[model samples]
Target: MSNGEMEERIIDHLRRNGKDTALKICKALAVSRSVANKHLYDLEKSKRVKKNDGTPPIWDLMETPDDPRPVLKTDTVEKVSEIVRTGGKTGLKAHEIARDHGLTRKTVNKHLHSLMDKGEVLKTDSNQWTSTGHQDSQASGDVTVSDSVLSKCFDIIGKLGKGAYGCVYKAQHKYDGKMYAVKKVKLTGDADAEVKALAKLEHTNIVRYITCWPSSQDWESCQDTSDQSDSSIVFKGSYTETSDYDSPGMESLSISTESESPAKPSQKHRKESVDPSNPSTTYLFIQMEFCERGTLTTWIRNEKKEQRTIIEIDQIFHEIVSGVEYIHSQNLIHRDLKPDNILFGAEGKVKIGDFGLAATLTNPNGAAIYRTKGRGTRSYMSPEQELHSNYGAKTDIFPLGLIWFEMLWELSTVSEKAYLWPDLRIQKCPEGFCVKYPTEHKFIIMMLSPTPHVRPCATTIKENLDRFFSMNHMLCQKTI
Candidate 1:
C-alpha cells in the first residue's frame, strides 16, 4: 500500500475499532511504528486524526466532511459535515457514513451527537444525521466480538451470548484468522482473578486459555454487577512470576497483577466495590478456545427440536466429569456449572468453560469451605451454595447431578420431555429413563444428595461414569 493508502487505512482502522494505540495499529496493519508515526504525523496536520499522549499514545480519527465548512475547516469536521449535508432532508444514517467513509457507525454516531450538542448539526425524526434543520424519523448484529480492544487481536464473527460478567463473542484471530471465543469482562477493574486461575490450567477437557491483552486504555467500559459484602474466597494468589514465560506477547503491554494482601481471600464479595480509580489503565479481556457447536444449552434445546439420536451423550457426560475432576484436582471450584458452561468442542467432545465464577479452594480441614457470597446459577446451585454457607469440593458435585439430569432428560424419549427440570429425585424415574443406566443414575442421585458432605466427589462421579460405560460398552461405542 502507498503512504496515502496507509494513512487511509489508519483512519479506516480507527473508525472501525473505536480507538486503539499506535502499537496495536502497527500490529494489526503489519506496519512499523516509524511508518505508522510518519503517516500519523502527516494526518495530524490535516486535522483528520488526533493522538493522545500517554504510556502508549492513542490515535483517534475525526469525522471529516468533504466540503469543508468555515467552522469545520479541518479535514475531519468538513468530511463529516459533507456526509450529513449530502443526505439533505433524508439525512445520512450513522451506518451510511460507516459504509462510505470506512468509519464505524459508533464513531459516526458519536460525532453526530457532539455536533448536535453544539448546534452544529441535528438528528432528524427519522433518526438520521442531518443539518440541525432537517425534519424527522427513527433508527442496529449480534457480531459476538469486542468493537474495541479485542478487535485489534480478533475480528468478531458473532456473539455467542451474554455471560455473567460480560458478553461472549465468537471471534477470529487477526493474524491466523483462526476462531476463538473472547469474553469481554469488567473484572472489577483488573483481570487478576480469571487470568491467574486460567493461566495455571492446562487440560484437554478444560477450555484452553489463549493469551489475552487488556484494553490498552478504556475505550468502552462494561457495566458490572453491584457489590455485595460477604466473605468467601479461595485462590488468593500465592504464586509469583516465573521465568518459564511464553513469548513477550505485547511490546507496549507491561501487564502485571499485584496484590498487597497476599493473605486476602481468593474470592470476596464486598459491599462497596470501588471503581477502578485509575480506570484508564484497566479493562480485562479474556480469550479462549471457541467451541464450534456452541453451548450445551443450545445443543440440548436443538436435540429437543430434531429428536435426532444423540449417540455421544455418554461420552459427553464422561468428558464433563473429567473436566470437573481436573478442575477439582487443581484446587479450583467451578462455583457455577450448568448446561451453558459446558460447551462442545471439535467432534462430539465436551469442555467446561466460563470460570468467571471459579474460586480457589483453601483446604481448612481436608476440605474447601467456601465462604463465598452465594455462587453458582440458582437452578444448578447446590443446596449449600444456595444457602450461602461454608462448603467444600462436594459443592460442585451437586450441580453435576443437575447437569446429568438435564442431559438424560434431553436424551430420553419424546414423551419424557415434559418434565426436564422436575424434581430429580422423582425425575421421570418411573418411566425408567434414569433406570436405563442404574450406576450412572445412582451416582447422579448421590451427587445431588441433600447433604453436600455425602455428595460424590468428582473423582467418584467419573468412576461411576467409567463403570456405566463399561457395562454398556457395546451399545455406547456404537451409539455416538
Candidate 2:
C-alpha cells in the first residue's frame, strides 16, 4: 500500500481500537514492525497520533483537527517562542517543538520562519531555531565564546568544526599568543579516558595536549528511541577537532545496544522527561596544539586534485607509522586510526590526533591487550574489533592497512573510493598496481591479514618503512 494509505489505515485502526501499541497495529494490519513504527512516528510528528510513555510505546490518536494544514493557534506560537528562548544558545529543531506542542512540523516551521522574518527568532547555522533575545548566561561563570567556555585564557578566533559529541574551535592563547585547537565535549561517565590518553601521550607525531578544564553549560540534545532494523534502541544526539573527525559531515554519534523489553519506560515518559525549555549539559574543554595544515583526509583531497608524488606519499605514511609506533610504545591502542585522525602540523609534519577511542592496555608489558567491543569509524575498524573479539595492537594495524592503500592509490573521486573500500578491505589491489609495487603490496596484504597474530606490530612496520625509504633514496641516487 502507498504511504498515505498505510498512514490512513494506522489512524483508522487507532481511532477504532482506542489506545493500542505499535506491535498490535503491525499485527492487525499485517505490516512489518519497522514500517509500523516509522509510520507511527510520522503520525506523531504530524500531530495526528500520540504514544504513551511505556516500554513498546502504546499509540493513540491525538485530538487534533481533521484539517492537515490548520493554522497554528496564537498560544501555540507563544509556546514555540518560549521553547526557543529557554533553549538559549542551544537551539531546538522545529520538529522537536512540534512534537512537544502537539502541532505538525510544517505548521511549527511556518511560524518559526515567520518569527525569523519578524526578528523575534533566529535560525542558527545548524538549522536550529532560537529566540533573538536569548543570551547565554554562561552558567559556568567563566569567559564564554559562541556559547562554549575558555574565552578567559584563549581568544576565540573561529569554530574549526563540530560533531555530535561536541565542537572544536580555533583559539589563540593569551600568554603565548600561539594558535591552538580547543575541543568542547559533553562530560559523560567515561569522558576522562580521552583526556587521560592525550595527557599521557607526548610525541612529535601525535597532537600535543596543552591542558583541559571542566565547565557546565546548557546544551541541546535530541533523543530518538525509535525501533531500528537492528532491533536496538538508538538515542541520537548532537566530539572533536580535538573535521568532526568522527564522520564526513563532522557529526559524532554513538550507537549502543539496549534491551527490547517492555520493562523499560514508555517512549511518552522519556519524551516528557526532557524539558524542551531548559536543557543543560556539562562539558569539558580540551586544549591542544593547532595544526594549521588540516587533517590527512584534507591532504588526500588536495593531493587527489594536485596529484602529489609517491615519494611524498611515502614520507607522509612513514611519519604516520612513526606516530602509531609511539602510541604502541606508550601501551595505548588508538582504536580509531584513519586519514582524518592523522593531522598535519606546521612544516607538514604528521600528527596523530583524536584519541577519543584510544584505550590503555590492561597488560602494559604484553604485546596484545583485550578490550570490550571496539567502537570506531566503520571503514577503518579491524575485523576482530568489529566482531567484538579479543583484539590487540594488531587491531590498529588493520586501519593502518586501509590508510596505506588510500595514501598510495590514486582513486580520483570520493565515489571511486567508496566503491573500492570493501574490495580493498579484503586486500584487493587496483589493476596492474600490485605488479608495479610488489613489495608494498605484500606489506599492505600482511597488515590487512584477517588474523590478529598475522599482522606485524607498528614498530616492525616502521622499521620496514625506514628500510624502504633508505633503499628508495639509494635507488634515486643511482638513477641520477
Candidate 3:
C-alpha cells in the first residue's frame, strides 16, 4: 500500500518471474499499470530493476548495470519531459513519470537526471521533478518491507495463497528438510500478542506453533540464494512437493487420520522467539506445522468422491470433540469451531486451529464462565448464541452437534442405517431412538438445548462418545 511496499513487491515479482513485461506485473499484483510502472521506475532509479531492449519491453531484476554507448536517444528524454508535465505543478517522481508514459524507470530516470543537470527539468527537495518550476509535495507515512525474509531462513518452495492482507508461501526448513506453512500476517503492533497466544496453547488436538519472529528487512533484501526465479519459486531435489500446493484450501484434516498418529507439540518446539532491534517492521511471520492432507473442508468433499462410508467420519467427529474438550479444560472458549478450522494433521489425526476469536472463561478455577454474545459460523450456531445472550461452554455444543449431524448425513451413508439417525434434523425420531437409544439421543438434544444452562459441556460430550463407542463395538470393526 505504501510506495516502498509497491517497489518491494516488484522486486519479489521479478525474482519469481525472471523477465516480465510491465503488463504481467500489473495483472499479477492487481496494481494499476501506472502504479507498477512508477514503482518500477523508482526501483530503476535505485539501480534495482532493468528493462529489456525488445520491442514491447520486458522488465526484470537488474542482474548487471546497463551500458550507455549511444548516450540514450533525445526523443526518449522529451517523452519523459512530456510525462512530468501531465502531473501539473506537483510534477512527479521518476517512477511516476515512467508510469504515465509506459517507459522503463531506469531509462526515464537517466534522461530526467540529465535534464536536471542541464537546467531543463528542475529537481525538488523531496526528489520530485517538475518542468513548470513550482514545487508540489505531499507527506508520506508509507514504509517499505521486504518479501525475502523467508528466503533468508527457509528454502521457499512456492506460493500457498494471497489475500488482501498479504501472502502465504510453502517452504522447507533448510536444516531439517521438513515442510512448513509460512504465513505472512501484517503487524498492527509488535508481534508479541500472537506469540503469547500461541505459547499458552499446547495439546494434541490443537495446531502446534513452531516459532514466530519479526523480520526487519523487506522482501527484496531477504532473497534466499535457493529462490531464483521469476514465478512462484521452487527448490529442487529432495524437498517434499505436492500437486495440491497451489490450493488455498490447505487441509480438510480427515486424511490426517492416517496410521502414524498426529505429533503432539513437544516442549522443545514451544515459544521460540527472534526479536530484531526494530520491531516496527511491517510484517509478522508465523511458521506452523504443515499438514499435507489439506483442510477438513476438502476432506468432506473427498468422501463424496471416494464414496467412503460415513462410519469412519464418526471417528473424526470424536477427535474433534477431543480437541474441544482440551480447549475447555484450559479455560478457553473456541468461539469459532467448524470444519474449516478443524484441520487434519499427519497420520490422519484432527487438530483444531484458528483461535482468532477465542475468549477466556474469566475464572480459570471454576465451572462458572462469563456470558457473551455468540461468535461462530451461523449454520452451526447454538440457540443461546443466536439470541446474543450471555453464554459459555454450552455455546460450542450446538454447532458441533449440527456439524456432526451434517457429517452423519452427507459424509456417510453408514449413518443412514444406524436406525434412529435421519438424513436431516427432524423433531421426531421414527426409529424410537428416544426410547431405545435414549442416552445417545438425549445427549444430542442436550447439546441443542434452547437454554445454555441445560446444555452439556464438551467434557460431557466426550464422555458420552466414549459410551457410544462402548455400546457399539461392531461399528468400529466394519471399516469402509
* Cα-lDDT of candidate 3: 0.57
What tens digits encode model 2's per-residue C-alpha lDDT throughout 346-447?
888988887877777655466433343536777778887775435678889998988888877777865797788888888887887698778889899999
Candidate 3: worst-modelled 10 consecutive residues by lDDT: 237-246
Instruction: Flag regions of model 2 displaced more than 4 Å.
Output: 1-149, 218-280, 363-374
- Model 2: how far residue 183 lies from native, Å: 0.4
Q: Sorted by lDDT, highest first, which candidate order results?
A: 2, 1, 3
Pick by TM-score: which candidate is best?
2
Candidate with maximal lDDT: 2
Q: Can you write out model 1's per-residue Cα lDDT over 1-480, one digit (the tens) per residue?
A: 667567766765665455678887887678999998889889888777887877788888764566332332334764776678667777776656766777654456557655553344665534466775321110001111234555455554444444333455555677987877666554331245567778888888888898766442332222223311121111111112111211111100101112232122111211212235532223466788877655676666657634533345777888888988998899888777777667777675677776765667875466533243344456567776665445677878877887776766654543454344446633334457655656566677777787878787888778866866776776756775
TM-score of each: 0.52, 0.58, 0.50
User: Which tens-of-lDDT digit does each residue in 369-452 have in candidate 3?
Assistant: 323333344445565554443457777776676566555444344344344433223334344445744655666666666677
Q: Which segments of candidate 1 are over 4 A away from where they belong? A: 1-149, 163-165, 216-281, 304-311, 363-370, 411-422, 425-431, 434-437, 475-480
- Please give the distance, in angstroms, between residue 247's alpha carbon in candidate 2 and its true position after superposition: 9.1
All models: lDDT?
Answer: 0.59, 0.68, 0.57
Is 1 or 3 the stronger prediction by lDDT? 1
Better of 2 and 3 by TM-score: 2
